[model samples]
Target: MNYTVNQSWKILLPLSHLSPNYLHEHQLFQRQTGKSFLRKIGGGMDKFPISPEILRPTIVFDNEINKVARALGLKGKRMPYETANGTLNVNIHYYFEKYIVLDVVFKQRISFGDISLLQKSRLSSYPEIESLVLAIAGLIVSGNQQSYSPLTSIPTIRCFSIQSLDDNQFSNMELVEALTGHIEPTQRIIDDVLARNSGHQTSGPIITLIDKQGVIQFIPNKPKLTKDALQKYSSCCNLLELMLVIEQSIKDGHLDSNNVFLSALKSLVEKPEDIVKSYTAQRTIKQYSKDFHLESRLSDLTKKIELASSVLISEKKTLRRGWDEFYASNDFFQVLFTALVAGLVTGFGILWAFLKGL
Candidate 1:
């Protein structure tokens, strides 16, 4: 199936590796940027222009670019440079401030035959985009003398695609499964959205969910829509760390165990909504740690995984016992049929003997 997708790369910083004081300073600077720091960075609050040279296939952050970054903090939000294929929008953690996101809006939406292939080529096919991301990261952490290294930050890719449907092409369930790669517990949400939008003459339904790799949103082609109007779907709870562990387990040849763990997790949740809520509620964020104590959170998740494994084993045993009883009943019927047939044959022989004697 072909899809037209809008792609973006989110580069998340390794918060654990950063210094507490450095983070605090950045926070203060961000707060003060509107009042005092704004004046300090440049003449006033205005958009800076990105260098055209950086748009070249091979980007080198020359001394001039470094000088500008040191003074202005790579403050530009728009990419003045454009390619025939698409235009780029670079945001330095504009909303979440946790990472930098490079959004690619194609002049004509880019086409892909397969989602997996598109994901794999996200960085490789666009070398210049990757270089631009690294350059921006370097520029952000350039002048700081803190022990934290920007190199620790790695970029993850996400994409939103639009696939138009023919009249009565597929049912809602089929469409949802096709778009989301069959991520469980999302169908209910999609149904709710579809119900809400029924009878209203508008675009098709949008389905979004978190897959094994990252978030995937399927949107109909609605041009000229504002970003604020966009309906972004996400897991209600922070299952990111849990997902990472599952992915790693698959890499280590624990696929069967992971499957059981996931199945148990789904079974444990009585309602679809519960799937979004965290497994545990006692988690609290610390002052120094940006990830809310990652190690501790992982340990908590580990306990849930163990519990899920046990539940799966119990279910398997129950299934086996049910099958055993079914087979045992069939065996009893077989034995009864054999005894009845032998008795009939003996009676027939005795009757014949009596008639001959008479």
Candidate 2:
């Protein structure tokens, strides 16, 4: 039975980290409904049907356009057109309920001439086109969510294009191949950014795609690295050494092993720079050296200091206890000694008197 395409049938591409069971369930749902999946597009088309100039410029923008189309419940079609730029594959999305069409043009490198050309396009008269222009401008400023707002609420025909200098790295065939899930176009962009910014202290600009709601639709999740794994890859020597110290503290019951290890691992992964800075500062202190003898001496010194404090406290407690006992017993020992001394002196006086009389 043929099913009519509806809003419910709108397809969402699987996130790279989706579980296999979720993917399988989605496949089953598609089969049961006899609905076409988004990934099936371009599979039956002739490979590289368009010129490389047009394909490369447009393909990088497809991921964002696809997300926008899906979110707005619009169906997308690739139409071929001839321009001075080359044979452009313009994507048109039809919103049946609103009776609106959106024309998305992509220029690997946009120029003032290109903007003028787009202004002359047939759909330029629509009010939505102005919003589309602003949205595209926002995207160009920073390929991030802060640049754009949702355009789906504008219920009219709209036209926009992405202009970027990085369009040359991909070709039409590669973009078409990506549609069939044979390659990940988003990952290619990330790899390109990383390649361009290799060894740089600053992070590269993050390329993001937004939906009609101005929500970021494409964000790559960094791989979660474990403590052991991070130690193996750490560039700072002190991180691993500190991990050893923390581990020893855990073993000696000075720290909660699970909590401390997790916290350390998180900080190492999320804020390695902070850790490196702290480690560098500690290394500057002579007493913080990693030499075994030095470390042992420091540990021994800590123990000796603690022992001296305990001894002082114990002696104070013993003296206080003795004073309390003497007061409570009415000084019996003191009185007995005094009596013995007095009796001896009296007997000696009596013997002297007798000797004198004789």
Predicted structure with the largest TM-score when compared to the true one: 1
The residue-by-residue lDDT of candidate 2 on 1-358, one tens digit each, is 1111000001111112212222122211121210121111112111211101111214434454445444433345322322333333332221111111122432222343323222322233333333443343333223334234533332222122221222223232332222222343466664543343233211122221111111011111222322222221121222222333333343343333244444543443344444433332223212123322334533544465567779999999999998888767967678778889999999999999999999
Global lDDT of each model? 0.38, 0.31
> Candidate 1 on 1-358: residue-level lDDT in tens?
3344444444433222332223243421232222221122223211211101112111233332333333433333334334445555543322112222233322224444444433432554565555555555554554243322335335553443343322212245543453344443276856753453233212335544333334444555344432311323212012332333333333343433444554433322223222222211111111101132434534445566688889999999999998778668867778678889998999999999999999
Collision count for each candidate, in order: 0, 0
TM-scores of all predicted structures = 0.37, 0.18
Report the C-alpha displacement of residue 80, candidate 1, in angstroms: 6.3
Model 1, C-alpha of 224: deviation from truth (Å): 11
| C-alpha RMSD values across all candidates | 23.7, 25.8
